[model samples]
Target: MTDKKTALVISAHAADFVWRAGGAIALHQELGYDVTVACLSFGERGESAKLWKQDGMTIERVKEARREEAQAAADALGVRDIRFLDLGDYPLRLDREAQDRVVDIIREVQPKWMMSHSKWDPYNTDHMNTTQFALECRMIAQAWGHNPGQKVLGAPQMYLFEPHQTEQMGWKPDTFLDITPVWEKKKAAIHCMQGQEHLWEFYTNVARNRANHFRRNSGGMAGGRKAEYAEGFESIFPQTVDELA
Candidate 1:
């Protein structure tokens, strides 16, 4: 077994990781954590409006384009591994096989932590469905009886990354990560998602706004350190610590 710590991120679509967790991925890499991103689908049908508008665009071609874009983004973020399950999207669904595949990855990575979508997303049903699937897979991964010889998963904290529209999605962030050091890397990763060019600035603004929240939460308005970029997350389970930091 490797000595390096690992992290896993299960994304509903190819570009979702870039938009939501690119900073975290890059920062974790700098901290010597091997971060792996698993994209359930290429988001060809639902998230690729620009490519769809082009002439002679087939589903396979769209998937290919999205794969390239996702790879570029993952490279920019310094991800250790990025894979597409290609299970299909627009209404991303997972069967027993897909769940098993996720469990395999969980056992393989043995991640110290995991990240996924919010529990509920009104704007995109696929996002919530993907989170549910991840949760279920995590559960399955922890069962020793399912696969006799396979390594069982530990109780890793699963963080729910901020959704596109937090207010409507009912996502309340309990953790704020300062990504000021890795903002440029995150921006580069975001730019790689050419299919969703409109989101580049939108997520940048989201990070900047989250920075303000981080400052307020970390200290106070008067004594808070000025953070330039940040990411917000909601933990699905309570964190256990030996001592209060």
Candidate 2:
């Protein structure tokens, strides 16, 4: 477990943090990282059908419920803060102003690492746009002239978390984090999304499959251990020491 690092995950929708990178988020928190989640929207229009199906569930009510759910998940993982940009859900469009706002958050947080949805997720337009926006913010934060009221922090290590359907989405797992110890925590966090309970088993299976892939490749004694879970990440840049130095 790496100690006392800061991690930020920017997601296109509130539930995305749970569905995609919950394991990684839990592991970071368990390792004493000051984790934060920035959700672009509550996913009211797209992902909240279950919530809205309840009698008299207004859009505002759905959003409020989702916000509470997200916060609970973050708290369960020991996250320090959660921010929601409240942009419109579904077909997310990253306009100039939205990009600037994201960039400002990056500069303010100065995270050691940033995680977001993969840009190539074909099933979700919002996911792709969020990825593009996050990448743009990363570049802007590190650029020479753009100032967002804070010292220009160097670019944080950027990682793309696996999309919901990895193989279909062309999400190859280039890096895997052994999140075995925090698997339960991850599950608990995901359980906070009451609206998504039906999909829990499928996602759990996905994590197990990723763990097996890492075990086969890494070839360590711990690799043979069963009941392990993993999270996959694709680095936006080479993880060379010079890059960080």
Candidate 3:
């Protein structure tokens, strides 16, 4: 296949991409990759506590606010396209229609690699549900018969971004991405999620902790490169390579 550097991120909620993989998106864009982010929901009902606390705040109003915030975050991350599916959240469910929509996006982008939530998340079922939706959509996107005459997707690696609580979610990171150069961009994206201010500090610390892991894995005290910030991912499929490093 010709190298047309492209990537896709399936975020369960509007701010999910920013917190989990903003740095990865920014770094990849710098490396000449066109990154697309698809947020399934605005997270207005479930994730927007601050906005809900407002007097007589409607779900539409909350969703509008979240959309604006997500757009700002996408700009900060240098995303090529940010698609908001606007499916309802809280009890995020993907029926046939929604699943087909996701499949359409996967086939349209035909990304070299994709990113989404971990396999499980008890704290928030939506997170896990979205991952399942991503997997199913990916499978459908690869089938030629799904929609004759349309482009089918190639087998692209799917990386699961770190969940909010790794231990609880059973997410183990096997890949560490050093995103020091784009740390500021990620930070700016993080700030855009003003509705969830508490997560700002939380995700920053997660990046710092991942940097420590990157240092150890890249090379210990022997000569590990210093990374101020990083992101962690768990690959769903084994990578194929001609030679092992």
lDDT scores in order: 0.93, 0.83, 0.94
Could you tell me the TM-score of candidate 1?
0.98
- As for TM-score, the candidate ahead, 2 or 3, is 3
State which candidate has the highest lDDT: 3
**Considering lDDT, which of the candidate structures 1 and 2 is the better prediction for this target?**
1
Best by TM-score: 3
The per-prediction CA RMSD against the true structure, in angstroms, equals: 1.0, 3.3, 0.9
Candidate 2 residue lDDT tens string, 1-245: 33346878999999898878888888877777877899999988899889878998898998899999998988877787899889878777678888888888877777899999887877888998888888878888887688645667575788899887777877666888888888888888889998778878888888888898778768757555554788788888766665542
**Regions more than 4 Å wrong, model 1:** none
Tell me the spans in candidate 3 whose CA falls farther than 4 Å from its real position.
Answer: none
| TM-score for each model | 0.98, 0.91, 0.98
lDDT per residue (tens digit) for residues 48-162 in model 3? 9999999999989999999999999999999869999998998887899999899998988899999999999999999999998898999999998999999999999999999
